[model samples]
Target: MNTESPVSRRAALCGIVVALAVPSGLVTACGSPAPSGTGSGSTPKQNGSTPTSASSGGALVALADVPEGGGAVVDGPGGKKIVVARISATEVKAYDATCTHQGSTVAEPSGGTITCQSHGSQFSPADGSVKKGPATTGLRAVAVRVQGDQVVLA
Candidate 1:
């Protein structure tokens, strides 16, 4: 016959307790980052300039996809998320979608600016600057380019 040490039993109990406390959705038994990208391994690229039509690299996104006089949040390169806006026929800009005040996602474009729904903070769509507060700092700008007919936010 064999006896288990008190420490061993205690560790086993602790593990069971932790397993119960963690949320089911937060735990990933596989321990892997989620699979990304189509199996084709092809991704749109930034041409170092903005694309003119409704496509980028080869992934085509319509300018109509963005709201008139506003912006839209889109999946950026490498699975990063970004906010893109069409300020004018010849002007477009992109910025990191996260807010500076408390790391909340910025609100979708409205009334010609992007506002933080979490704290009522406002920012200019053209430059991503704080138009009003609890956010004292401006939004972070990302490089934007046009490739083929798509607007690429790098």
Candidate 2:
């Protein structure tokens, strides 16, 4: 005899749809607007080739933009979103803004942690490591270096 309740069956179907839609790129959660050439279906542009708001003539952002022990979300190489954090006065780190769990753009780092609003995933700005659930994988690291007064892709 079928013992599955109607509510349970509906919930299961909804779960299936979300599972399929997320991986298939049919759904995108909370995040900043992705650049024109960068999306799940589109091929990401090569580094140093795509122009972004954060980068100008090879500079990703001004060092002043990132506060000490905090971070900012900037348009990154390949037209992708990147989170740049200032660990110390002379130290900085960068990571792909897309959350590993669901592709939602991570929020700016506060208290040395990056948070994903979509699913509440937390990541450490120090090494892009996941510190919360729903995201088992860490954020992708992006090479970054400080040049004079600006942050540039390394």
Candidate 3:
């Protein structure tokens, strides 16, 4: 008779993996991933340009793309969508394109209002405030500024 019981192959491999992977911080599947591209693949190139960080003021879109009294939906940081509205010639405001009511994406600001086609939610372009029904809350504000002729994340 064998003096000691044999351990299964799966058990041995699990032990080896935990010993090696845990110590090196390679085991990350235990919890859910992060939001806002906070996970492993956050740094991505946009518009075929070099990767830029918010601390360094990343360019989002050209100023000409956004009309004087209207706004334009553009790709924001972490692959998120945002509405960049031109408040005036030298001022711009931005907000999350995701609608607060039902997680729908809001459209560009037209006639001085950003409209969500999903539920007819209208928001103010200057301050991201709710202006119509179906949406009780306004779109979330995104930190951004106009840098030269480019709209950049601030």
Candidate with the larger TM-score of 2 and 3? 3
Q: lDDT tens digits, residues 95-127, model 3?
A: 878888999899998998999999898988878
lDDT of 2 by residue, 1-154 (tens): 9896566775666566667764434333323233465544433333322212334347778999999999899987677888899999988888889898989999999976899999999998888888897998888777688889988887
Model 2 residue 26 distance off true place after TM-score fit, in angstroms: 14
Clashing pairs in 3: none
Q: Which 10 successive residues of model 3 have the least lDDT summed?
A: 45-54
Each prediction's whole-model lDDT (CA): 0.66, 0.77, 0.77
Model 2, TM vs. native: 0.63
The residue pairs that clash in candidate 1, if any, are: 49-146, 50-145, 50-146, 51-146, 51-147, 53-149, 54-149, 55-149, 55-150, 56-150
Candidate 1 per-residue C-alpha lDDT over 35-57 given as tens digits, one digit per residue, 9 for 90 to 100: 45524233343333222222234
Worst 10 residues of 1 by lDDT: 46-55
Candidates, ranked, TM-score: 3, 2, 1
Best by TM-score: 3
TM-score of 1: 0.58
Full-model lDDT, candidate 2: 0.77
